[model samples]
Target: MAHKVFISYKKEDLQFKNQLVSLFNQNKVDVIDKSLNDIIPSDNLDYVMQVLRRDYLSDSTVTIFLIGEHSSEREGNDFQGRPHQAFIKKELQATLFDRENNSRSGLLGVVLPNMYDKVYQGTSICSTCGGTHNIVAIDDSTVIKEFSANYYIKPHNKCAYTEDDRYAVLVKWDEFYSSPEVFIDQAFDKRKEPVANRVTVYPK
Candidate 1:
């Protein structure tokens, strides 16, 4: 069940990205790397997006977003005429877009080590369910919000969401690195599920 995967991450997380790539190679993982290596030299935002969608993301089955400390910061002004979101934002948008040539890809968020403590804050008693639940703190970026919002159709009470309720599966870097296939497979399976239809490719 080899899958073509596209990785979306901020420039600061290059080392983690490289480590993930190296891990893939070392494990002889059956995953195809379709991540962007060289920057596309263009001032036109639309052109850059077109190239990314058509070339890098068209065939990718899954998109793994590496969430770092500053991943939510807004940056990038490559588009000369109009204001635009960062490249990572655009990349996730493209990955979620369902076109004739490219269907929506399964989305996975990998929290980097730098933000591990912030993201995973141990367990807490759920006020609503009266059960212990993991306190996961994800960024409030529009891109992240949009995907997460659509994914949890039926939350496990007001306090938490079970893994089955999530459309975009999230994992810590270490957990993901330890067993990449399991997460990738989980993401890939989402594409065929009913939740796939709930995704808003371009959230306003």
Candidate 2:
């Protein structure tokens, strides 16, 4: 039997998400997206939670977050301010808690390769990040500096919830996305590596 993976992401990376879904499908991995359900715009947070909870506990064995530059950006409008991160946090917390009690699998975090360096400040896009599992960039300078600066930040800290969350971070796209084999190896066990004083890109 094949493994079913569920993807939870912000709407900004619709194109990339489709491409990724295609890639995973080609590899014979069963992938599903939460947004496939015709969720109405007027649905309240509680309704959203109900939907997420159902999918989170379905046949899906792992939840992968398709992270982009603006994955954690919080936006507000006149009528109601959508708390994307906070709501996602709640969903994840519920899923994890349920999985822990019911003996289901946990989640995975896969980030866009070099998203932070490539995105601009005013980009009107949102990203999706799993609780922690993430991909790193090979040549992003800010990622190296920030990861070296601090191991972890509070959930509400700017570093953790920035428009571009991969700043000065530990993970690099080059290192993680070198090949499918590398991705597989890290997917099973993601460890925090020591930040090299000088970042270097190796020729593949």
Candidate 3:
């Protein structure tokens, strides 16, 4: 059977969404476009997750998280003079387990090449909106392992949520941008393959 993919990303990544829709159109892949509503408050974490599983994620078997610069960002806690929210966590946590209505879906992360910014020697900042990216990428295996572990571990601080590696298939910005079908296929078919060896490309 063909893969049923659900794309995930911050709403600001419109161009990335367009690219995905366009690619799927040309290649005849299936994309389910159900995103979280904006009006929902971060304080309603329970409702947010409930709606996510029941409404947005119940139909798909894989989630394609377009890992942009700010994909790891989170809402400030309520005590910080704001409502507590963990939308990033909600999207990611969806990948680890099955919704009551759907089977557990795998995750695929396609990094945005444009989100990479060059700051200094051997160091390029990969973040959204000109901010610094604080996530670590020690090596392919380390990166993959860290991601695998973090998906199951939830921290107290919402602002510190940068564990996008739940995506077993991690695609480089250009590699995915140029030829998405190849990697999308990899995500769907090679379920147990060692994604640890997949090339880790950082954009500048």
Candidate 4:
């Protein structure tokens, strides 16, 4: 049977998500489209969770967070200085604790193109981090920025929630485009295994 995969992504990458959906359909991948972008925004988080559990993530076997630029940005959770109200948190929690068959859906992440880097006060954007900064870049000549934007910040802040979520720290993400199917398969297979929070693209 085909797995019903719920695709999660930032609204900024709508085009990429559509193209990815097309490819999945072309390949006849057994993933059902259960994305929640059809209607107006929910009134509150409770309403949102109600709708998701009752409909959006219904019967989903896996969730593929289509990582993109600003995917991990916590703007949604920043409602009037409220952090716990983050929509992504609700989504992730729903995937693991939705009112379903009491089984957590497998978690898989596709580190899509345009996955961005985060900038903090003591750090500067890497020169090779492509053009444009997603967030405000600071002038920090005193403190040395540990992570240079290469493939280092590729996954964004995936492990922000759990110390160990998925994805081995050493996996070559550059190969994802060439072997997407293989990557998905591997990720799905190991979804249940324990994983460590990846600090760098090239694990130290």
Best-fitting candidate, measured by TM-score?
1
Question: In candidate 3, how many clashes are counted?
Answer: 2
lDDT of each: 0.72, 0.42, 0.55, 0.47
Q: Compared with the true structure, what per-residue lDDT tens digits does model 4 show for residues 26-67?
A: 766656554443422765766776677557666666666655
What would you estimate as the lDDT of candidate 3?
Answer: 0.55
Q: Which stretches of candidate 2 lie over 4 Å from their true place?
A: 36-42, 73-79, 99-104, 114-204
Question: What is the TM-score ranking, best to worst?
Answer: 1, 3, 4, 2
Runs in model 4 deviating more than 4 A are 32-34, 37-40, 73-85, 98-102, 116-174, 191-204
What's the TM-score of each model vs. the native?
0.82, 0.51, 0.60, 0.56
TM-score comparison, 2 vs 3, better candidate: 3
Candidate 2 TM-score, true structure as reference: 0.51
| Superposed Cα deviation of residue 83, candidate 2 (Å) | 1.7
Using lDDT as the measure, the top candidate is 1
How many residue pairs clash per model?
Answer: 0, 12, 2, 0
> Candidate 3: misplaced stretches above 4 Å?
38-43, 73-85, 99-101, 115-167, 190-204
- Which 10-residue span in candidate 1 carries the lowest summed lDDT? 75-84
What does candidate 1's lDDT look like per residue over 98-174, in tens digits?
Answer: 87867888998888877878777899987777899987765464235544554555434556776666778888888
RMSD of 4: 10.2
Q: Is candidate 1 or candidate 4 better by TM-score?
A: 1
